[model samples]
Structures are given as structure tokens and as C-alpha cells.
Target: MEYQYPFSYDWTTQEIIDVIKFFEAVETVYEKGMNRDEFMTFYRRFKEIVPSKAEEKKYCNEFADSSGYSPYHVVKKMKESNPGDFVKMES
Candidate 1:
């Protein structure tokens, strides 16, 4: 909960905020539950900011190292879920 999020210096302030929001939504998926639509909204914006697969993996791996939550898992679950479903990770 007290870890720094992975971010790029090249990004604008709003882009950084959007990236953090997406990471927080990933956290929410593990901590409680998030609506699929809402989580995807965050993910979509995140993709806009981090378009490269390598870059996304780097950021997500850093986040997992710091926060102990896996963005990969959340996205995997998201892929398996329907629009109205709630995406949650079991502890």
C-alpha cells in the first residue's frame, strides 16, 4: 500500500494520474471487487498511455513487485469475464 507506482517522466501529469488509477483499479480487484466495465475503462486508458506490450509488462511487473498485486491476473480474469460481471481476485 505504500509503494511507488511505476511511471515515465515523458508522460504528462494527467497521463500519470490515469496510469495510477488503472493500477489502483487492479488493486481493487484483489482487495474487494470491481465491475468489469469500470475496470476495463481504466485498462483502456492505461493502454493508451502504455501502448507497447514490453512497456506494459515492465510497468506491471514493477507494480507487482512493489504492491504484491498482479495486473496480469486481473487482466486475465477480465478476459474471461462478461461485461456486467464483477472482477475479483481471491486471496
Candidate 2:
């Protein structure tokens, strides 16, 4: 299956930090203003691990509620993993 936030290899640390900050800010805002039930929904949606079906459903549910407002969305810089040993990207 195609990754929703498909990893990119060229991203700098600064870029990733910037995204993290933004996500945190959104979490803070929603936590302050939204009700407990909605906030719980938001929190669950935020902590979703990569490549999980449960996470995918939370994403769809959040989209329906806000029409496209989520804080957990991050562009991960993922590399291939080897089951038995280290995997390296082509250089």
C-alpha cells in the first residue's frame, strides 16, 4: 500500500523540527478549546503509529469532523529496514 505521508530523504532537521512545533501548537489549541470527548478523539488521532489500520481510521474520522484539520500528520524520512540485518539506501 502507498504511504500517506511518503518519506522523503532530503529533508533537513530544521524542517522536521518546524513541523513538530506546529503540530504541538495545534494540540495545545484544540486541547484548550474543544470538549473532553473531542479532545480525546484528537489525542488518539495524534499518537497514531505509522502504517497502522487503526491510525488510518482515526485519520478518516478526523477529516470528517474538521474537513481537514489534523496535527499528527508528519512527513517521515523513512528508510528501508532489513529483517535480519542493516539496510542501506542506494548512494
Give the winner by TM-score: 1
Q: Global CA lDDT of candidate 1, please?
A: 0.95
Candidate 1 residue-wise lDDT, 1-91, digit = tens: 5999999999999999999999999999999999999999999999999999999999999999999999999998998999999878986
The lDDT per prediction is 0.95, 0.36
TM-score each candidate: 0.97, 0.29
**The 10-residue segment with the lowest total lDDT in model 2:** 74-83
Q: After superposition, how far is residue 45 of candidate 2 from its true place, in Å?
A: 23
Model 2 misplaced stretches (Cα beyond 4 Å): 1-8, 33-91
Which pairs clash (backbone N, Cα, C closer than 3 Å) in model 1?
none
